[model samples]
Target: MHDIAPYLLQNDLGGESLVEFEHEEGWDLIVVNLARAIDRHVRHQAKIDPESYDLDLIYFSQVKEKKGSLRAYVTMPDAIINAYVDFAELMSETTCEVTGRPGLLHTKMGFVKTLHPDVAAERGFKPVD
Candidate 1:
């Protein structure tokens, strides 16, 4: 598993503020890179204090309506909500729904979807399996 502790600390927040998957699992490189990109964008463009916000969660799952489509959920403070959403939409073209491939050339919606782990995995995101 990749250690995200150092990255989380770089944001000036403790590990406790992050979801468990951020600490325990070996995420796809695309996911890690996206996190870093969002972090940089939020810090540089939004100019928000890291301590004031919490990265409540970051995870991957399948899009039920669109088979083989994957979605990434990244929850943070409302203060930087627009920035995160914009970034997600912009990055959607470069993100692949299946296999977690990055830098693909395609357009899609980037809004985060809320789904149970079992449902997501069964739908084919299957990060845990």
Candidate 2:
């Protein structure tokens, strides 16, 4: 997450700026805001569903210098890879639509694709056949 730190920091800085920094050089600030907006939008939609899809929204912190991994325990109704891909795409599109901007969703989609270890233990949260 080293790569993501700067943007997150920028978000913090911008939030603190009070002036709103209306015309900043970094578009990442906009993307970050858009992501937050999209997350809210998607979660609202998810809440309306009969099943919440067992989506566990997780966030964690670690030492800032080195890259760190995020761990999640999710049991998707579909196959693991497919669920990851579908969730990523859905989130990306939702983000873009909410933001009316491009590329942010696509970038987040790629991030989702890197998730690993979709094995039995992860899947065990679901009932056996």
Candidate 3:
């Protein structure tokens, strides 16, 4: 897992060991996207109300059965959970599990359904046919 401790410390999230996993081929991009999403959410919230949305606590748990699956546990005062989930869903769509394809066309829905069913319902997410 590239030692998420450094990243967390750099972001001032404290040095709390969250989870560990083997580093996969394309997992770096996924993590980058997730961090971006969370950072964006935090910045936006800070703009709205600096005092209330000051702290953001999020942790990731690696799902052993699923190769590239990372479950996020968020503990923020605001409703930014959906934002993180949405970014995860988006990353899942872009990542390809098989040969020379642009996207994971077959497993997109199943991924979102399994990981973030509530997000799917909230965003009216459906298969891109």
Candidate 4:
């Protein structure tokens, strides 16, 4: 999170405002990078056209994993930001949710997840068919 701390509103608002994630530790970097990218773009845009940028649509409202992928819910919609979100969500599909390693979808006893090959094998999961 330190990587993105400077780009987060929590730093300005104080008391843990921007740090929130409802997912495994592996995707931590993914979330951090995503936030950083989004924040950078918005701040840049805001500076260029202060009157057109809506602060309301600049922050994330929810971030969670659903069906082995990421869901980043922004308070409001911005077409450009949506493109970044879309890319991140697709990236999560091939990332391990436990170790941040390259991974693929697997299933263990009917539970589904994205995990590194080693992590999946150790956990008794097989590649999803």
Question: Each candidate's TM vs. the true structure?
Answer: 0.33, 0.23, 0.48, 0.80
lDDT of 1 by residue, 1-129 (tens): 135323332322334333333211112443456556656555564356556543433222221212222244444434454454445445443444333334233222543322334434454433321
What residue pairs are clashing in model 2?
Answer: none
List candidate 3 stretches off by more than 4 Å. Answer: 1-13, 21-23, 56-70, 97-129
* Candidate scoring better on TM-score of 2 and 3: 3
List, residue by residue over 1-129, the lDDT tens digit for candidate 4.
545633343423433455467889988888888877777877788899887665543456678888778788764457877888898898889999999999899997877888899999999999998
What's the count of clashing pairs in each model shown? Answer: 0, 0, 0, 0
Each candidate's lDDT (Cα)? 0.39, 0.29, 0.45, 0.76
Write candidate 3's Cα lDDT for 28-106 as tens digits: 5566566566666666776998876564343443312153343444445245656665566456555532221234332
Q: Name the candidate that leads on TM-score.
A: 4
Q: Any residue pairs clashing in model 1, and if so which? A: none
Number of the top candidate by lDDT?
Answer: 4
Put down candidate 2 lDDT per residue, 1-129, tens digits, no spaces. 224323222222233212132211223333344335434444555678736532343221111111111121222223542344344334333232222233221213122211122321242322122
For candidate 4, the TM-score is: 0.80
Worst 10 residues of 2 by lDDT: 60-69
* Model 2 clashing-pair count: 0
Q: Candidate 1 — which residues are off by over 4 angstroms?
A: 1-27, 45-66, 77-129
